[model samples]
Target: MSEDENQISIAKIAKKSTPYSFTVNILAKLHRNSYLTTIHEKKSYVLGVKNIWNDHNGNHATLNIIGKAPLTPFNLDSDIFLASSEQIKNSLGLENNPEKAIHLGKIPNVDIIASPNIENFGRLFITGKSGSGKSYTVGVVIEELMKKQVPIVIIDRHGEYSSLKILEKENIPDNEDFFIKNDTEQKYLGGIIEFGDINMNPGADLGIEYLLAANVEDLIRSGSVIIINLRGLDIPVQENIVMTFCNRLYKASTLREIPPHFLFIDEAHLFAGKKKSDTVEILKLSAQEGRKFGHNLVIITQKPQLLDVIIRAQAGTWIIHKLTDLNDIKITCNSVEGLGYDADEEIQNLLPGEAIISGDLTPNYPLRVKIRKRYTVHGGAGYNVLDYITEGDTLPKSEIVEKLRRSLSHEILESASQEIISNQNLSISDLYHQIDALRQENQELKQEISDLKTNDKDKSLIPEGEMKEKIIDNLAELNSIPLEKINDKMMNLMEERDDAIINLKDFEKERNDAIFQKQSLELEMSGLKVENEGLKDILSKEKKRADDAVALAERAVAKLKKRK
Candidate 1:
């Protein structure tokens, strides 16, 4: 064959080996909604497809699910799915191809789609690198389940899951279920799991074992969705929570027709060791048993490759979002068989929210899924004081007046300001009232200033905040005097009273330190004096004996002289 003939053959083969997209896209008109498909570098939502066929030679070509720019008043059931690389959160980026996005209308992505017949996928295994939306995805699912009245138990190691329900209280049981751990009534609510609160002897293990058993008793019978969120836990604490929860869940699940709960483990790689830790071993058993007993386990980790081989083997579903690690992708994808994952040499090219979903949810192998927009806030878990709020900057007038009368606002604020106590001395309800008053006062002041700016009101008109301050000072001064007089004696008496108490606590600590030092010095001085007294006694006795001896010698000399 000639060199040119070889080149021609190579070109023919190259032309024939064209790449194809399996993403299902259908262009069908649904109820009167103008629709267009625009696919971009990050995200996609394919709602429905119009056609599925082979272009030629049995090569598959489906309607390429394309994305439309986010439409306002979007149809809840829009036929076309939208995709984009742009993220709802700017801080988070996709591990896969940023050029394409995955947004399937309300379809469960592979991560959450497969579980026993239930409202949710139940237990989940979230795998991703740090800051790769593992916890974020878990929180979003929990938030949804919680809205549906799911009773969630978060074994919070870093306190991330502790605040999951803070913003959703109004939608819950009298706002009681959404309690914060460090909030004023948190101890009373029993969220922290303390020994004394549970009536255990001091320093006992809080009978967590018993709590687990009892909690299972209640949940299994009730057939409620008990989401045990395990996120932000260090490796040790994570293992303990998993160990206890899995043991109890397995026991309860096997014994009852209905399983007590679903278990969600975050950073699953830390505990999913092949060496078989007791915790991991039991968890593996429970994950398998959960399928039969209606209990399910979802392991979440950034390094899915490191998860225990047996447990990963039992996973009936595969939700492959954009994974950056080649080893993780190889381990996770290869670990499971016949799951529709588009594996390639460049695995990192896939984008966020774009996942290859397969397993029980999909009929044939896996399908590419693009997640839809959520109404909940998605800025990943961090403390925002506003998220815990029920009422915005303001409250009712009656509540504010009541707050002032019950605890002196001055005393409460002073206590916090002075650091007299470690906690805010006022009730949360009281603080809310004050917050409302401040908000209302601020609003009124703002409105007044705005009016004054345009109305050219009299200069004599003082702002409400300033007016309130002046009135308070005048009233305080008047209250200090008796009989409407200057009352020098009373003024002097008050001055003495204040001087006597000026930072008594500060002085007390200092005085205590000095007293302790003085006592120690006195002890040392007494010991030294006793030693000196003993030395003096010994010297006095010796001196007495020496004098006697000298007298005796003198006597001998006198006798000799007399004889002479």
Candidate 2:
């Protein structure tokens, strides 16, 4: 075809065939060296000069280029083969190393090789459903990288990677024999692999200074594999430790001139979830900026949808295994390129240990392949209840169990104590109400006593003339009563009335004193109420601490049981 014909616009292509089909067909024929570059609304092709080769007859011919202009579509084949080793080297800007490529696994008929370079650090992501060999694949990559003398740090959420310390043969369970060494022996690559367990129990020492004193950076610089076990830690504590460690590591990397280090976070969604957290923020920053500081992140998680978009976007290499959940599959497909309808079907049908590899680490395509075996032990296997029962083994040490029980007991006691305090507060409130009612009644009684005193005073102030007339009538009716006897009787009655008035005044004074005593008691109760509220606050804090302690202890117990 003429050069002009080769440069037809997308508008013209759509006239002859649908844009989607035409674009796919043209991309299928595009050479590896040719890239679709867009300028304005016109699509142009840039072919590598090196790709122009002379034939054996010394005759040179240009390869056929097919595509429409305006829109340069990417090849949509999900099962495209990877570029050769030399092509990969050139594409990734790496020196050609015949032995650097480690055999990852085989596809339908071809073996797949992956050579992870330092330049592409902090860009690998592996995800799969549980029991689909996610951890196992991580082990394979770690083993290969260790042989390459790359420093690695594993954030082992479930204490799985600790078995990296043991030889493969030693770590195999007694009830199962899965690995068999063949006659063709792989190279025995060794390095300094160490296990460090940070106890995250509530009272455990988690000071950042202690972490610095552990010489974590020195060990990593020496090419050691450090596995940080966070099995029994509370979620908050785990997040804190991971965040602190990453921050420290980032700061350290900035100061020291060290070899590139790889950080592998297994179950990474826990740390870099959609929710905002200190751990998530730190991990996002690390993923974006860690490359310049010689730090790389390899995040592994089963739930890709739960990870933050920014964190997922930073990954340049993605190894996706079988995922049954449609939402998860949709998320994985969206995150990656060259994966669509056919790829979706393939993902669902993928067997355990099989995955589709994509990203900058691979060629401009997705390669479906089975993951290779690990030289190290896979420590994150599911427990078999049958084995424990059939083996007739007793329970392991009960120290963790006992500690958990005690913690729960302590929490319960604190809760009960808080309840009691709450009840006392209620009682104090009721007492205040009662005292207020009593005060109201005392005021009413005082008014009634005042009314009685006024009536008594009015009765005592009756006219003397009327009193004399009444006495004279009584004396007349008797016709023989003496005036002196009458007068004496009137004086006795007046004296008795005055004495009664004095007694009523004394009773009013006593009632006033009783009201004063009640006011004092109410004041004391108010003070006690303030103290109770203070006690409640203190108890709330104590209860929270106890609850956290109990949660950690319970996790420890569960971990112990799983080990047994």
Candidate 3:
């Protein structure tokens, strides 16, 4: 092999480069959608592939600029070699191995680690057709993010992400069984926000506003995850819900009301598609400006073509899976900054669970990664109708009995408590009414007795004197018996009221204790947030010092070479 053989055309170099490697074409590619693969460099020494394209004066080749070794300007016909994998890793800052980098999966010889801190405010967009494992890839990313304790809120359009709370079961539950097969430890403090009566495990059904303002913010601030399940909702209602959430979140972020968090909207096309609506407008705005407020949006959809154009273009990271539609592929290629014709072709042939992660998330070049498996159960798995016909039931009778007993006990206790309170108040009111009626009867009896005595003294009814005395005596005996019975009943009622009052006081004390604990936790979270910000500032300063040192060394080397 002569040295002359190495000097080849730009197209030949791209063709001969290792499979799955990305290249930047310097000459303006005759495509309006050329902005698809642009990557902005953070380091000054790094060759920033500006979206600007030079005129095509026969500079048709692209250079695989991965290594840090600077090269002098060369003509299209000049000999240029591809960088080794090790050099590529070092140039992309992978050699230092930052602790916060998220492991996305692996490429050929290197693991793909994404540093969200290095990206454009953690905004990621994912797209693939159905069954292409886009959702699975999202789950993998979410699992990795969970390890870092990042607050995550997911707009689960199909109620699929609820499984993130539970560990994956060893066996699928029987079709007729309503309970999860295995009772495993919960992965996270996750909750589901729903409008309907259906409630899942590990979470209470919360309304949209209450979840957002009261529970969701608190939960996420405490590093918990929440899913806003919109299953069984009308399209318009779903859109309205998403709109309200996005608008409120953006406003909250702008006002610094909530801490930095990630919002994952699955099936985003339904809300912010090609249609020009409020959802599209707010989503587009959030994608563009939410980064400043630490509001990261991870938009997922099966159809990129249908998603809002502005939102798609604003994504800093893209995890692309197999896309058969030409328009979807075309949109992806155009939105991504550094993708070329070769990468576009690879997108079409990618296998399930395999994705091409490009944009700010990658290390200069696009990486084809085999997404790792989920740590939790995948709720979106396809259901088999035949499973219902099995003879044996997966759920044990004992477990069912225990579950029923617990549920019934809870309902009974709650009902009994309410009933007790109602009875106590009603009994007291009835006693007061009975006492008032008895007092009026006693007064009337006294007046009648006085009148009868007056008539006897006037000699108007001497013959009936004996009959009157008998009537008076009988009336007094009847009143005394009735009064004694009322007093006994009142005493019993007073005992019940005293007992209820004591119970109420105890319940209030418990509630106050819980509130105090909540306040303490919130204060601790605030302290942690302040500490985190301080550390981030220190890291930023250190990074600047390192960059300055590198710049100085490069200049010194250049001067030494000039003297030589």
Estimate TM-scores for all models.
0.42, 0.49, 0.52
Model 1 C-alpha lDDT per residue in residues 1-564, reported as the tens digit of each score: 233322221100111211222332233322211112322234333322223344544322233222233333232222333222122111012123311322222333222221112332544555655644456556655544443333344433332443432333333233333333234442212222211111212212222223333345544432133323322212333455556655766776687744344566654665566655677778788766676776677676667766788788777665566677667887867765443254533236545654555554332334444443332334333233244446544211222223323444444444432331122223365479879999999999999989977656554566779877988999999887766255445435644554454367349957987898899999999988998899899889989989998999999999999999
Please tell me which model should have the higher lDDT, number 1 or number 3: 3
Model 3 Cα lDDT, one tens digit per residue, 12-44: 222333212233343322221111211222222
lDDT, model 1: 0.46
TM for candidate 3 is 0.52
**Ranked candidates (lDDT, high to low):** 3, 2, 1
> Mind giving the per-residue lDDT tens digits that candidate 2 earns over 1-564?
334433442111111222223222232343423322222224333212112223453322122122222243433321112234344334333324634554456543322344444344447999999988888888878866765667888887766765554346553335422222331222231233322222221111122223323444554664456556665433444566677677778777777655678899987887898877667888999899887788888999988987999999888789998898787898888888655554677788888888877776553446566776665556752212123223554322213223333344444545533432232212354479879999999999999999989967896587878878988999788978776588557645644654564487559856977898799999999999999999999999999999999999999999999999
Poorly placed runs, candidate 2 (over 4 Å):
1-99, 111-121, 169-212, 381-564
TM-score of 2: 0.49
Which residue segments of model 3 deviate by more than 4 Å?
A: 1-63, 67-69, 73-86, 95-98, 109-121, 169-187, 190-216, 381-564
Error of 3 at 493 (Å): 53
